[model samples]
Target: MNRNIFIANRLREVLLNGHWIANTNYKEQLSDISWQQAIQQINELNTIAALTYHINYYLRGLLTAFETGKLEISDKYSFDLPEITCKDDWDKLIQDFVKNAACFIEKIEQLDVEVFEKPFFDEKYGSYLRNIEGVIEHSYYHLGQIVLIKELIAQ
Candidate 1:
């Protein structure tokens, strides 16, 4: 298998399915959570809904970069999560997350291995390889937080 394709597949697995690390991916962890649970605050830490939005927001930014060849996201606005007042709102957010994740995987698969070696948008930002790996790492980092928060909420 192509290395790029392999990486893309791994990204999909980590984001949407069981991965080697925790045997639980973002989708699995978020699957059984209710809207109330998602918005529950534990010790003033971020709610599951907010974390989910933050994760997908970065992914959406990366997807935009891949599609438009421009990195237009800023950290200032990254955590601006929407108000989840109802089940439908939370459900729509999850749906959007899944769709954006699929789009990200598709974009990664379509890129050539050579592109991975090239700078991602700018020289300071590093190569596509680095950014892509960073995305995986970032997701896993938040996945851990989400899992912990869910556990805490359950108690």
Candidate 2:
């Protein structure tokens, strides 16, 4: 398989499986959680919803670059957090997350594998592929945190 295709597929799987860990059962694992459970300020630092937003935010940018062939680096990392304070808002967030995630992967799927080796001078990682790998690692890192927070909330 081509490098970009492989990376894109893995990124999709990462979001599909490792994105959420609020107080949800297996049946609704991807799209089930109370508003309070989502917004609960776990560990005095971040809410579950906040972390989820952060994950999606970075992944969105990563995939955007692949599709557009432009390295759109952010001037500032300024996402507050995911806040589904009401049922309607929660449902919208869920829908948007699913839709945007698929769209993001589609973007990544369209990229040329040769671009992966191309260097992005402004980005710390030196190459586009490294930056993308950072995106995946960042998601998994927080995913672990989300899982731990869910376990704590369940206790």
| lDDT (Cα, 0-100) at 63 in candidate 2 | 58
TM-scores for every predicted model: 0.96, 0.77
Which candidate number would show the highest TM-score if scored against the true structure? 1
Collision pairs in model 1: none
lDDT for each candidate structure: 0.89, 0.65
List, residue by residue over 17-129, the lDDT tens digit for candidate 2: 43333333211343656767877776686766776667666656655665676767463553565446588776666666666677776766787888788785455558878
Model 1 earns a TM-score of 0.96
Q: Tens-digit lDDT track for model 1 on 133-155? A: 99888888889999999999988
After superposing candidate 2 on the true structure, give the runs of residues whose Cα lies further than 4 Å from its correct spot.
Answer: 17-30, 63-77, 121-125
Off by over 4 Å in 1: none
Superpose all Cα atoms of candidate 1 onto the true structure and report the RMSD in Å to 1 decimal. Answer: 0.9
